[model samples]
Target: MSNSIATWMGKGHAAVEAPIGDDGFCFGSEPSLADVCLIPQLYAARRFEVPLDACPRILRVEELAGRHEVFGSAHPSVQPDAE
Candidate 1:
């Protein structure tokens, strides 16, 4: 979580890679809830400190997701206006 956001910090960035399961996995595939759970926690992770460069794949997914409407609605800053 914390690690995911730091990748966006720019100059000071470092990616944190996670282990693909022994079941065999690779980069650039459909993400799981594990990926879904990352972005918000990344906010907190930035507040603290987490390495990013270790996980370039996750960050790439983060960027790709950001371009989608679904991701936009899910973001706290994009919440619906109160009725």
Candidate 2:
């Protein structure tokens, strides 16, 4: 499980490292559908204790998304019915 998480996150890290954009997001300055999808997976990764020390780009995207008004409000933990 740990190896699988590392492999996937490594792939994600490489994708984000490309010349996608100057902004610290999965694609560009603005959050897109990719960001929407990636954020939850990142949340799950953290929940599962997946080490992210090497995935700086993924972490950066997660951080940027966290500050976005839409993403911030939509986070699962912030939902009205959340435990």
Candidate 3:
């Protein structure tokens, strides 16, 4: 499981290292479907204790998304039922 997680995160890291723009999103300056999907996957990765030290671009995207009003509001941690 750890190996698989590392492999996938490594792939994601490589993919985003160059393409991620100054806005820190997966695609463009504004959040899009890719961001919506990426954010949740990042959340899940954190929950599962997946190490993200090498995925700086992914982390940057997550941070920027968390600051967006819509995305911030929709975070699982902010839900009423969250523990």
Candidate 4:
């Protein structure tokens, strides 16, 4: 699954144009439908120890999202079911 996700994200990275801002979100400056979808996948990929060195754009979006309150609150580590 991790390998598959890595491949999927690799394709997403190559298909997406460069971000307009310093952060590499696929859409506008704020998190959009693309981010809502991608961030969770990226989080899950990390849990499975998928190496992300190949997707710098995705990595940049992940970093920026990690700093936001909405994403932070929804993170697996902070979820009510976390253990």
Candidate 5:
């Protein structure tokens, strides 16, 4: 990968491993901004083959979001304009 690409992916990896709940945001409730961002990011991470096992909070949030009806609403396949 190019230096820029490596740097970018490195940043993402850092984000995935960073501590959660460190900013006083409640994750026990409905998903927050971090949860929202992490979903698509993890999707990309999987496609890009980035190691995410270190990001426990993201996996937990994703697993929780995956279990609920609310997550379905945000699915691209279910979008009103989706193909």
Candidate 6:
């Protein structure tokens, strides 16, 4: 599972390289479906302890997303159902 998640995130990291631009989110200036999907995958990767040292773009995305209220508040650590 860890290897799979790492590979998937690596692909995602490559995909966002050119398109992410200065705004940070995957499509245009605001968060889109791509960002929405990417955020959760990142959470899953972290939860599973998948190393992300090589996926700088993904790490950047995760960092920026972590600052958004809508996204930040939904993190597993802060969620009401989290254990």
- lDDT of all predictions, in order shown? 0.53, 0.76, 0.79, 0.73, 0.64, 0.74
Each prediction's TM-score against the native? 0.50, 0.74, 0.75, 0.72, 0.63, 0.71
Candidate 5 per-residue lDDT, tens place, 2-75, comes to 55654576587676556665332225466677677767776666656666666666666677777768776886
Instruction: Write one digit per residue (lDDT tens) for candidate 3, span 1-83.
Output: 48788678767657756676655587877898988888887787777677778767778888889889999899999899999
Of 3 and 4, the candidate ranking higher by lDDT: 3
lDDT tens digits by residue: candidate 1, 33-81: 6556666655455456764555565566667567666767787666676
Candidate ordering by lDDT (highest first): 3, 2, 6, 4, 5, 1
Candidate 6: where are CA atoms >4 Å away? Answer: 1-19
**By the TM-score metric, which is better: model 1 or model 4?**
4
Candidate 2 stretches with Cα past 4 Å from truth are 1-22
Candidate 3 TM-score, true structure as reference: 0.75
| lDDT by residue (tens digit), candidate 2, 1-83 | 58787677767656655644555687767888888888888777777677778666777888898888999999999999988
Model 6, residue 59: what's the lDDT? 71
Q: Which ten residues in a row have the lowest lDDT in candidate 6?
A: 14-23
Q: How high is the lDDT of residue 3 in model 5?
A: 55
Q: What does the lDDT come to for candidate 5?
A: 0.64
lDDT per residue as tens, model 4, 1-83: 56787777666555642543555565668888888787887777677666677667777888889988998998888988998
Best by TM-score: 3
Q: Candidate 2's error at 45, in angstroms?
A: 0.5
Stronger candidate by lDDT (1 vs 2): 2
Alpha carbon RMSD to native, model 3: 2.3
